[model samples]
Target: MAHDALRDELATLTTEAADAALDDIDLVPTLEAARRMNAADRSVPAAIEPCLPAVAEAADRIAAAFARGGRLVYVGAGTPGRLGVLDASECPPTFGTDPSQVVGVIAGGDVALTTAVEGAEDDEAAAVHDLDALGLTADDVVVGISASGRTPYVLAAIREARRRSATTVSVACNAGSAAGRLADIAIDVVVGPEFIAGSTRLKAGTAQKLVCNMLTTLAMVRRHKTYGNRMVDVRATNEKLVARAFSLVQDVTGAPDAEVSAALEACDGEVKTAIAMLLTGVSADVARSRLAEADGSLRAVL
Candidate 1:
């Protein structure tokens, strides 16, 4: 069979390669194999340790852009793409960010999120098309993700972002990947060999998810999305969250439940505003102004 350029390189690797060892193992018991895989997975965090500084730097850049009204965009394919979308989608409910503020671009568009699209990742032009649709600018931050570190679609997106003077970062499992070379800041967490041999969804996926979580969560934290450790800016859309809002008010002010309830009502169930009202003993309007001045960070006002 004629191998694809990407697969050609992948096929040349021995068991020594990070993603090929699993196929060679047969003597181990099923339970033991699973246990070993679990144990091996712990090394993923350690693999990422060296890149924390880079990750933090990227977070700083992203936070600065977002503070200035720029968007954070995540682009990828397969598992990496899905993870990007997951992180971006959570920003709204978690930090009360607008849907457009954080966006995710998959190779085959939204459809690829659920099902694989044939040759979708190979189309470099599609990457630019997606970025163009978003009206990308220098104020934006584009993050490209790929486990093998050689996906054309991801590389194209990063290159396009950089060409437009946008801050570009690439997250990959393999070192020296093309995507890494093109990014302004490249994060390569080498989680050495997959348990299932070339199945990046295992350890590689775990590392990527961890990094993605840090990238966005830390950016939000830097932007004053939380008060102390509590998610003060969380959007209360459901019963559990509404209850959480009341609890947060009580926790921040150490006030009686009745007073907390009153503050929440006054602020229309906005946790940050409710906390500000309870602590400052001011009207909701005044509390809102103070919170706004504080960048919606509850701890800042206190």
Candidate 2:
């Protein structure tokens, strides 16, 4: 009385799934296999090149919304989710952006960030709930990350975001994915079959991370977070960052360390203002005004 129908359905579902059985392969050659895996990773960037236009478009839209005081929200599951959270968390110290300006929403919430959540990615309704919790509006930008591009949670999140009139971008490894279709902009970096087959954390994850870096970094650059290629807006929260700020000021204005220190003191340790004061030979207040007029871009005022 075996359930043949259920057995067949399970088999069909797993038919194309990547085989995790590598035990039969010779044990001593495993290091060679890992090397080959690393070699395969090199193709990920090439795969992502064609999608740069789409990625850039998304970045431009994100910058616009951000300039208008909208938030940038990242939604994903598993590794992709963790990557989004990591990127969002770094924005504050890296670009001096408010923590609330960038947000990360994982499928199973905070706990899932550290541990796997059974069936969390299958919860379609949960995505809507997460968006609701954020009070998403038309001014927001939502980026959904999913290697397979079929995760119900991510797809539903992007769909809901779009319905709310928010800008939605989908980052995926597979072409023609549901996540892509549901988003306003789709960046599909087809890195081919994974080295371990379907183990997307290898190639797909790398591509997603790279794209995420580009998206956020380029947006910050557009927002004038950098001045003359230096992170002028960086939050000098530690001794290391304070030293970095001093070095950046000295490098930008060709001033001695003593002058840099004086300028920093005048600007209350604000790197951008200090650089402005040093380069423009003005008081801190006048330097602040010049920087404000140039939208905090050193290149513009210099």
Measured over all alpha carbons after superposition, the RMSD of each candidate to the real structure, in angstroms, is 2.2, 3.4
Worst 10 residues of 1 by lDDT: 12-21
Off by over 4 Å in 2: 1-28
lDDT by residue for model 2 (79-113), tens? 99999999999999999899999999999999999
Q: Model 2, poorest ten-residue lDDT window?
A: 9-18
TM-scores for every candidate against the unseen true structure:
0.94, 0.91
Clashes of each: 2, 0
Which candidate has the highest lDDT of all?
1
User: How many Å off is the CA of 57 in candidate 1?
Assistant: 0.2
Candidate 2: residue 275 lDDT (0-100)? 83
